[model samples]
Each structure stands twice: as C-alpha cells, then as structure tokens.
Target: MNKNFTLFNVLPLVIGWIGIKYGINWLTIIATTVIVSRSIMSLILSAKLHSSLSHLSETVRSRYRAVLRNPQLTFSVAIINMISLALWGQEESLIILAIATGAYFSVRHQLLRKT
Candidate 1:
C-alpha cells in the first residue's frame, strides 16, 4: 500500500476521536476528515511530483505541474463543504471554511516554493 494512502486513512481517525470527544455531529466530522485528508494528500502528491519531474516527459511534467499549482479543486471542495455545513445549520461552518482556505493556500505555497 502507498504510504501516503495509509497515512491519509490513519490520520483522520484522530479527527474522528476529537469529534467524538467534543460531541460533534457525524456530518461535520466527515467533512473535517475529507478536508484534512485532501489537504495532506495534495501536499504529499505535490512533493512527489516535484521529486519525479525529471523522470517525466516535458509535456507531461508541465501539465502535471500546472495542475498542482491550481487551487480550483481545493476551492471547490471548500465551497462544497461550506454549503453543506450551512445547509445542515452547523455553526462551525465558518471554522471549516477558514481551515479549508488555510489548507488551500498552504498547499499552493508549498507547490509554488518547490517548483
């Protein structure tokens, strides 16, 4: 199994535990898990992409690099999570939004810095 994948699955259990301890609803817990998991995965993949760029053809490398640099996927996921939280009447939606935005920028910065 991929180390990143294993890490992705395992790290969220901590979030789940925190949620349970705090008595947070399942939906919010799930959303938090998704956001955290995606953020970690994106960063891991970005690092891997940076390391492997030399092995890829020019065209493929450029395209992959561009995709990694884009923040649209992160933004979309944040928007979806925000909308879902709002619809569910969760007050912590804003907190989630902040976290998602932070993650998005952090990942973008990492990719930009590496490349």
Candidate 2:
C-alpha cells in the first residue's frame, strides 16, 4: 500500500494508542470511523462518476477531490463509520476503518485538478 494511505489508515489508531497510553477518553475511535467512511464515500462517488477515467478526465477527478476537502462530507462519513462499527462488531469495523483510512490518503494522490 502507499505510504501516505497507510498513514491515513493508521491515523485514528495512532490517536487511540496515544489516548490509551495516557488513559484518556479521546474521540479517536469516532474520528477513525469518520475518516474511513468519508473515504468509502469518495471512492464510491469516484467510481460512479469516473466512467472514463481510463482516458484521464481531470474534471471528474476534480469533483471528487472537492468532496475530500468538505468537512461536512467527512463528518457524515465518520458518523456512519462510527455507527457501523458499533453495530457490526470489531472485525467489520476494523475493515471499514482500514478502507476509510487508506482512502483518506488516496484522495490526495487522486486529486483531480491538482492544487
């Protein structure tokens, strides 16, 4: 996996580890859920819209990139991840979290318009 993506995936875990070490009730779990969920959403959106990405369409990629920058979008994804993690149990939660985290970094690499 890409180093950046791996870092993104581990972001929440790192925070959680820190909290665990310090004995704090940090929202790292919640944060992880959000980050992962947002990534899944962006990926789904990109796949739906990137019908011709094989040819390299900057426009579609740009739109998805904008989605990445949206706090609201990220928040929603995080919320969904949290709820899903709560109900689906640990394994599913971990998988989704991983996807979300990995995708978080992928978004930067896949930025459409390029900043």
Candidate 3:
C-alpha cells in the first residue's frame, strides 16, 4: 500500500473508531481535532520563532507573538462548523460560534492595547 494512501485511511479509521466508541458526532469530532491541532501547531511555531528572535525588542517580539496567536483560522473553522451544525439542527452551534468570536475579539483587543 502507498504510504500517503495509508496515512489518509488511518485518520478516518481512527475518527470512526472514536466516534463509535464515544457516541459523538463525527463532524464534531473532526472539527475539534482540527481546531486543537491547529492551536498546538501555532503555539509550537510561535515558541520557535520567539526563541530565534531573542535579540529583538520586547515590543517587536510581543507583536509577533500576538500575530502568531491570532485566531483567524480558528474563527473560520468555527464558523464553518457552526453553519454545518445549524444546518443539521444542532443548537450548540451558536455557543461555539459565540465563543470563537469572543476569543477573536478578546485577542484583538489585547493586541491593539499593546500597540
């Protein structure tokens, strides 16, 4: 079997197993996984960048940190998830959307304050 093909199949297989075992919706599981993974990757990349730029001024470093922590991707994913859930008649979508939006604004506010 091709390695790429095997890797692709593994995700769905694991997702399916998790959904079945936990009795959770597949879409919810996928969205949660993507969101968490994105966050972790962002944090790791930001930390690496911060360390590499240790000689930079605090203002510059802080701004870069804020930019890296921006929640645009997370907000986009949450919006899509909200729409999907709403279309499926799930009431929890509103709460998820609200949280994502709130986080985005909160971070933006802090960034603006720093600037």
Number of backbone collisions per candidate: 0, 2, 0
Candidate achieving higher lDDT, 1 or 2? 1
| Model 1 stretches with alpha carbons more than 4 Å out | 1-24, 65-115
Supply candidate 3's per-residue lDDT for 38: 43
Cα-based lDDT at residue 10, candidate 3: 41
Cα RMSD (Å) between model 1 and the true structure?
A: 8.1
Which RMSD values do the candidates have, in order?
Answer: 8.1, 10.1, 8.9
lDDT of 1 at 66: 81
What Cα-based lDDT does every candidate model obtain? 0.56, 0.54, 0.52
List clashing residue pairs in candidate 2: 34-78, 36-100
Give a tens-digit lDDT track for model 1, residues 4-40.
5445444444554566567777844685556555655
Could you give me the TM-score of model 1 versus the true structure? 0.41
Tens digit of per-residue lDDT, candidate 3, span 28-109: 5574455444444445554554355536677876765566475565456456545544544455535644554555455445
Query: In model 3, which regions exceed 4 Å deviation?
Result: 1-66, 69-72
lDDT minimum window of 10 residues, candidate 2: 84-93
Off by over 4 Å in 2: 1-11, 54-90, 97-115
Among all candidates shown, the one with the greatest lDDT: 1
Count residue pairs with overlapping backbones in model 2: 2
Between candidates 1 and 3, name the one with more favorable lDDT.
1
